[model samples]
Target: MNKKGESKLTIVITVFAILIILVLSFLFYYYAVKSMSFSRSETASLSGYADNAGRKESAGLRTNVIIFKPSEVLPQQQKEGYCFSTSVADPFRQDAFRCQVENEIFDPCFTTEEQGIVFCQINPLAPEAFLIKLEKPLPKASLLEFTQDNWAWFVKLEDKTYCSPFTGTRPFFSQDQIAYYGCKSNNIEEQIVLIGDLMIDDIWTANKAVLIKEKDNWAIKFLEQIKIDSVWQ
Candidate 1:
């Protein structure tokens, strides 16, 4: 082969190799940036989730709860961590045995930030109705307030009255401004905000990371030591 032709072929091959390297580098950087952006978005979302969980736990007012001190946040971003999580991956799956109870409206949720215990009143209307005592010092007695006539207790959002049969939730659980769904014939699901962040410029400020991503059930579980009973008395 001619020396000139061989030199030209070598140059072409080198150029091709360089182009391939550049393309690969660009793609790698693009994906890396995308991953970073996703991480930030998730952090913000989880932060908000955690915040809502705190509020719900406070507003619940179920029973036997100690005051919770919010985690210390420095004036500057000195601390970066997740707080106030029940930490239960999924608490409402079948086979979840929970001791059921009834009580005054209370916040019975536990987060990792506070402790490893989750406490709350379990609605008896569930297929396997039982109280969920996730926190320490289980309920000594039961709060069975169900009746044959009423399947579940819920506050009516429309008229905000008919407090004749208060069963599960508080009548004035939240103000009129907050929107929620409730049914007279069943346990009204407040759809309470159990987790969240301070949304600032579409970015979460204070973060609460709830990593739960199950589609079928909730985060409340039954007690392993407890079972269902037709009569709570």
Candidate 2:
């Protein structure tokens, strides 16, 4: 071959090789990103599916369900000793105690503040009723009372009610508002009774209240918290 022709051939081969390398690199990057994206989507799907399954299973075993989610701000009328009643004729019955200053509603009212809202478990006798004390209490009323039947998601088994407040976390996220409640003839198996937030290992974890049922009665046994690192892993 002539020298000019040979030089031209070499240039063409170099350009083709460079183009092949670029194409291969682009394909590798594209697939790598796609695979990573699929992994993340799969993880999210699994989490959602598992949560849905838990909710469905809980629904099958629940009875006398009364769901309640407290409002951040109370209405003008509710500010004065709000009473939660399911009766359509008398919705706001005035038999409940008012929320006073210094957190003195009753002895040992379990009060906890989460995300600026104060929740007081006023009546141990009535686990279904909780006093939601507003951050900005109205001049007439500082506390708004809520019953299980007042809101949207509590399961009552016999005399006891099982549920938890919303805390923007797993199991208790805004979408999945139903509290996990299940009943078993045998008391040995851990049944998910409530979904709530708990501090575990110095980190806030969305925990489940595992309960044991014996002879038609349910009692809490332990708290189960799950933290998934990676579904693929």
Question: Where does candidate 2 stray beyond 4 Å?
Answer: 58-233
lDDT of 2 by residue, 1-233 (tens): 99999999999999999999999999999999999999999999999999999998866542222223333543222121322222221123222222444433321122233422233333222544444445443222223365222232222223233333232222332344444323222345645544532223322233456655656554556655543111000
Judge candidate 1 against the unseen true structure and give its global Cα lDDT, from 0 to 1. 0.32
Using Cα atoms with residue i matched to residue i, what is each candidate's TM-score against the true structure? Answer: 0.27, 0.27
Model 2: lowest-lDDT 10 consecutive positions: 82-91
RMSD values, in order shown: 22.4, 17.6
lDDT of each residue in 36-111, candidate 1, tens digit only? 9999999999999999999987665321112222223311212122222211211222111233223333222222
